[model samples]
Target: MTEKTIFPTRLKNNDYKFTVWAPKARSVRLLAESPKLEITMNKEEFGYWSLIVSGIDAGTRYRYELDGNNSFPDPASLSQPDGVHEASEVIDIHDFEWTDDEWVNIPLDRMIQYELHTGTFSAEGTFEGVIARLDYLKNLGVNTIELLPVAQFSGFRNWGYDGVYPFAVHDGYGGAKELMKLVNTCHQKGIAVILDVVYNHFGPEGNYVSNFGDYFSGKYSTPWGEPLNFDDTNSDEVKNYFLQNALMWCRDFHIDGLRLDAVHAIYDFSAEHIMKQLAGKLDELSQQTEKPYYLIAESNLNDVRYISSHSKGGYGLNGQWSDDFHHAIHALATNETRGYYEDFGTPEQLSKAIKQAFVFDGLYSKYRKKTYGNSTKNNSGEQFVIFSQNHDQVGNRKHGERLISLSSFEMAKLVAGCMFVSPNVPMLFMGEEYGERNPFYYFVSHLDEELNRLVNEGRKEEFKTFFDDKGEAVNPASEEAFERSKLSWGIQKNPEYQSMYNYYKKLIELRKNHPVLQVPDKDKLTITENGKGFTLHRWQGDRQILAFMNFDQNDTELEVPFNQSGNMDKILDSTSTNWNGKGETSPQKIIAGETIKVAKEAILIYSN
Candidate 1:
């Protein structure tokens, strides 16, 4: 059902009917500190306490005081202007003046996503700060911007995953109104926003879901905490709690898409898995609103069924983050083979990733000590989201060093070439475009001192297990980590940063303009090793483009099967000099079986 059927369609006079499914409470009163008012509840047959407060306008601070004590944020609060400990605030979605109506949803197949954390994407660390950079994103040719979760967490600084109130906007990064403004501005610039949501666990401090009912199950456990009760006796209500939360973002907040966090950890043995239910609901909602909706899963399971459409007997998600692809690329670029990397790291593995989404598809994993991952052979490349680096891959590291720090500039350019030219949807972590040097260390803040100590000790212990060297461990709870992660906006003005930025823009533009890049035909993508480098081929109908890469330290001769070309034109090159040492050139042609010298760490794009 659309918004027209549920609640007052127009929301006339700015008044609202507030209701929540809190049955055990003796008394429930609406506590709006400013413009103070009280509301009494009417008990229903199901014991739900509800009350309608008239003249309840938007931007009004409010909360519920149970039995005249023990106040908490509203379960359905549209905004938490204060932190999670404080009262919630009422917000009118229609009150905001939105500027975008002509924006068409960017198809998932064509999406070149740029992921950013609001607090770190800019120096200001606010929604308004990001709005100033819309033209930068548009010029970079990105169609979708995936944000880390913006739900209200406890402290002023957080990664935003441990959010307690799924309905409320994070006050630290500008309240709900400003968030809506950010989305509105992004849409106006023809960019879609995809929010990353965590449903598996809640934060430590203000988590109050258990107060209502048996929302968590002791039967199962996650690495973070207790597993959500999705298959227990009261599983119906527990499921509804999360489902409604998802709907609230899409329906009330007008979010375009969601990236489901770690679905593999969501233990559900029900007849209808939570993912299936979510997919079905999103499908219905999309049809109701006549807007394109998408679901992307972050699963280490490597199960292609997670993305398969429901009609085709799969989960029906639009796409999923391919960690296999990330791991292979990251290992090759940095050569860090700890933990899961013990199983994968080879030139062959990287080549396998070029054809298949995952390197270990149904292969025996030495790390897991079992066979893992499903084959992605039949799936289109668009079903996978590949990245050289992301928040987790960077922040979760020992020091949060980016590819620019770990590898040379030539390797950096080569990594970009692989990501942009590959068939899968490419995602650039924030600051990666300009090779920004800031580290994205994991940061958190806890109210309890013991908990803070435990987090720091645990971090050190985890790293000790992987790498024996022990240095000063980053205390996530401290103010320093958050400050360090913030991007330096001034980096864009530097000559080196500008050159790298322009290179990214050109790559993205080429990806968009070239049909061969979007061609999902698995047969069309072919990779062959020639000399010390690799030659990648993607056929666009009858025509073909060849991408040659030399990963060796010294310039090497590449045997070109020249009979495959009529006339050659250099489409793109990552070198300072041509085939000869004299001058700049595009595409150089040679004999049918002649050999050509390819510069070290260079990428050459040839069109025939």
Candidate 2:
């Protein structure tokens, strides 16, 4: 089941066998410094050229000279130890130690995911820095860590979506060695690592693929740049470049899964789409390794085909980001009913999303003025990863305010309880546990002055029409904005922040302890509205847990519909007053056929 090795065996000879496709060039030569030498390449069909020069090896600085004027780095460079403007550095993938042979697969249903950007997750902003906080994550009950893209970009400071070198790890994050270390450490801790990858398009800077061939299609376009040439001629290589990169992360870095970014923007008219190909290859790799390798696409299409199995005439991806679910919950929690939020906000929309994993389902979108999204009714809750807040929803905002910053602490707790107990994988953004007030603003360090100005101007113009004067005025490209986005870890020591952190930790523990909550059974779960309050119920074995939430500002009464016979006990409550103001015991309660008073902006779970 293993993919056929592109490189059959290690190159033992000191001579470097370099190969590249340069059809436009009459001649291509490999030039190296230190041990200065030049080797002529034998031209092959499709503009490919190769050369084997003695005394050249890994770590040797080398560049390809095209037509004796244009010089570019290797398209499939093993390492870009120096910046892309500098020569490429080669490295051996086989040179690392790995553990975690006995790790068993944790089903998506059981995953409590945490999303982080390696550059910002810690003060050091390195992979090794994240390793230092493994115990904190384990204590928080996070089973999966979804990292933002670590691929090489123009400079050290970036959000990682604009990555150019798919294979090379950012040097700022300790490069390849640190990447392997991060994955291996996570595996040892029984935590699965999923990478957020950008395959829709490359960044505007440091891209060398176009020089090799027509890597982009003029036929299609993206907001960032031109769409990848998936439908054009000689796209087989272009597609392979990304497909191979995906496999490399799983195989070389031992990454457990991949979250494909912005699949809705990935245009492809080919009979066999690139996504299908990637899933097919991943399936083969998973079988070969006897381990689970999952793919999660961040698609807004709601096409159901994205999560359907390949055997059932679909893309065969494991799951998706579930933006509809986020939209529904976000609009309700924040009460910001603008833009795409226009389609959600009501209890009906939120309840539908919580129960059915989709809010639209081929319904008309007033914003787009067209029917959007297909039914996800047949898809299990496990097929969707639900979140109250994520990088995009937070950073894309004018102020990049987190959930805790936008709403009260009580509302944040209620939101977490709803998302965590829902029939879907719950994903928490970094510092979410303690309600980190620092923003997660979009940041980049591009040297191009005109590009930076355009980006800054575009951001302001886009926000001018919707947000307030304060939110619309701030320049996203400013250094002050990026500095303000860093997480304030000191908040963890604060009593208020610590309380919220404990609340999330307890909710996660409760989710794991209750079999009904852990395994999302779309059939057994039911949501019933009671004016300003809602009751969510789930049955596991002979026992059932009742979850109640009051969204209104005042205390509300909810009448139970089910028959009550057994002695019911309070299991979990989000209210801070219930625990005797921290570390004190409180008596449990049971009620039968009575009006249940729910505290304002609080969630409570009852079991018998």
Number of the top lDDT candidate: 2
lDDT for model 1: 0.77
What's each prediction's TM-score? 0.93, 0.94
Q: How high is the CA lDDT of each candidate model?
A: 0.77, 0.80
What ranges in model 1 sit over 4 Å off?
1-13, 23-29, 34-38, 45-47, 66-69, 530-532, 553-563, 577-587
- Which tens-of-lDDT digit does each residue in 1-608 have in candidate 1? 11211121124554576766565577777677557887776765443566666766666787777777777777656666767677777766667776666665788888889999998888788998889888899988988899999988887778888888877778888877788888888888889889999888777777876665566888888877777888886676667767877887776667889999989889888978888888888889988888878899999899988898777778888889988878887777677788878877676777788788888788999899999988887688888889989999899887878888987777777778888778888999999988888899888887767877887888887787665564676788888899989887574468667767777887888888877876545568888765447778888777777787766655454544544656556676766432212233334654345455566666777776
lDDT of 1 at 37: 87
Candidate 1: residue 506 Cα off by (Å): 1.1
Off by over 4 Å in 2: 1-17, 44-47, 52-54, 471-473, 554-565, 578-587
Model 1 residue pairs with clashes? 570-586, 570-587
